[model samples]
Target: MKRTTGQLAVVIAALVAGSATAQDMSKIVNTPHNMANLDVWGVVIPENQVCLPCHTPHNARAVEDGASQILWNHALTEQTFEMYTTAAGHQGGQPEGTSKLCLSCHDGATAIDDFGGNEDTFDNVMIPADRLSNMGTDLRDDHPIGIEYPPPDLTGYNDKSTFTGVKVVTINGVDRVECASCHTAHDNSYGKFLRQTMEGSALCVECHDK
Candidate 1:
C-alpha cells in the first residue's frame, strides 16, 4: 500500500520528536553530574563547559595503579578508605579503577571545581558532608565496591558471566565491582544515575541471587 506524502511527513515528525526526547533524557546537563548547573552547591564553575570537570581532550591526569586512564581531568583522591567485610566472608579492599575516580569528588575531600589543574577556583569547595552523595572515606557501611564478584566462596551472588545489567571492572587480573558497575555517570533517567530501576529491588537482585 502506497502512503500519501502527508502520512510520510507525520511519520518523520514523530521520529524526530522521539529522537529529541531521548537526547534530552541522556544529557548530563539535565542531571546533577553537570557541575556547571550546580549553583546550589555554591560552586562557581569557571565556564559552562560540562565535560571539562571530569574529562578533557588533552593533558589528562593519570589514574592510579590497576585503573586505566580515561582522559580524566579531575584530581584523584588520596584518602585511605576502610573497606567492608561481609558476613558471608567477602572482603573489600582499597578502591581502584573507576570507583576511585568517583571518590575524587564523593569522598568529600576533593573540591568539585578542582579540575583541569586549576588552583584558584573553588579550591576548597568540597561536596557537603551531609549530602548523601558524600560517601566519605569510611566505606564500611556502604556496599563493597572493590571486592571480587561472584565471591570465591559466597553463595548469594549470581554468576558474573551471566550478568546483563551491571558490570565488573577487571583490575590486575581480578574482576571486581566498581562504582561504574551500579551507576552511569552521564544518565539519570532512572534517578540517582542508576543503570536500572530499584523497583522491587530489581537492581539489587541483578547480581545477588536473593
Candidate 2:
C-alpha cells in the first residue's frame, strides 16, 4: 500500500509534537535549528511578547498573498524583491513563501513594534527609511517563482517521476508557485524547508527544465 503525502505529514507532525512542546521564549531565545525556533533577521528574538512578532495562537490572521488556512500574527510588509529565474540564470521573480515572511522584518520597511494586535494604522506606523534595505521589486536576478513544474508528458523523466513532486497552482486563471509544493511544512532533514536533501543542484533540477 502506498502512503499519501497527507499521511506522511501526519506522521511527521506526530513525531515533532512528541519531542517538542508549545513554542516558548526559551526555545526561541536560543538558536534556530528547527522551525519552532525563532531567529529575527539572524538575531534571536528576545523573550516576552516579542516572540509574538510572528507566531500567535489566538488571533493569528493570514496575509493577503498567502493561503488563508494559516493564521499570521505579524503585519506583513508591502515591499517587493527580485526573484530567481533561468533567463538571467541567477535572477528571480517576485518573492514568495517563507522568503516573503523573512522580508517582513528584514526589509525594514515595516516597524518591528507593529504586530497583528496593534491598533496603529499603517500610515501611523513609522519605519526608518534609511534602515530599510531590501532586494527591491525587480526579481529578475533572484530566484524564479510562480512557475509550474509538471510537464504535459510525465513519463519522459523515467524513474525520476516520483521525485518530480511539482503540481499546478492556478490563481485567477494564472499560475504561481506555492511554498508548500517545494518546502514541506513539517519535519524535514534539509534546512530552509526544502523538500529533499541538497547535494549539488539536486533540489533545483527536481522541477526545472534541466
Candidate 3:
C-alpha cells in the first residue's frame, strides 16, 4: 500500500531523530523506502553524507537572521527575489525563509559538496562549479520572497469567508509572513514542505485572493 505523505514524513522524522550523529544519517538515506521518496524532490544527495544538510549533530547554526533553528554547514544563499502577485503585497524585500536553503544548491552558484565552516575558496572544492547563464543574480523570473502575506489594508477582505487565520510571525520586530512560515525544512506532509498542495490555479489563489 502507498503511504500517505503524512505517514512518510513521520517515518523520515523518526529516522532522523533516532540517529543523532552525522555519520549515522546514511542509514536513513540508505533506507530503501526513503531513497525513492527523496528522489521526488530531486535531491541527489549521496549516502554516507553528514546529517548537517538537513539536521545537525552539534551547535547547529540559525536558519533565519535572528531565529535559532538548527542550520547545517552550507552558507545560506542571500539573493533577493520577486514573487508572483498582481497586488502590491510584498514591498520590502525578497523572502529568505527556507528558500535560502533551497538556493544553496539549486541556485547553481555553489557546489553541492561544499560544507563545514572552513570558508575555503570555491576553487578548492572537487565538485565543478555550475555555469548556467540563466541563473542570474536578479530573481525576477524565480519565485518571490520576503513579502507580507496579509496587507494592512484588508477592509474589503473577509477573513472567515477566505478560510484563513491570522499568522503572527515577527522578524526583526516587523510583522511579515515569509516562505518558511508555510513550509517545513525537516519533514512535511506536502511536497517541498508547502502548507498545502497546489493543483492548477488553486495554490496561487489560496494566498493571492486575499
Best by TM-score: 1
The residue-by-residue lDDT of candidate 3 on 144-180, one tens digit each, is 5555445666544324235332232456665555545
**Deviation (Å) of 154 in candidate 2:** 13
Sorted on lDDT, best first, the list reads 1, 2, 3
TM-score of every prediction relative to native? 0.84, 0.50, 0.53
Against the unseen true structure, what C-alpha lDDT does each candidate score? Answer: 0.84, 0.51, 0.50
lDDT of 2 at 120: 54
Q: List model 1 lDDT by residue over 1-210, tens digit each.
A: 899999999999999999778667577988899987788778766668889889999998877584768899988898999888878767677788888889999999988888886766554788898899998999988888888876888677888787776788889988888888889899887789988789898888989888
Clashes of each: 0, 22, 6
Estimate candidate 1's RMSD in Å: 6.1
The stretch of ten residues in a row with the least summed lDDT in candidate 1 is: 115-124
lDDT of 2 at 19: 58
Question: Which is the winner by TM-score between candidate 1 and candidate 3?
Answer: 1
Error of 3 at 171 (Å): 1.7
Give me candidate 3's TM-score against the actual structure. Answer: 0.53
Best by lDDT: 1
> Tell me, what's the RMSD of every candidate?
6.1, 11.5, 9.7
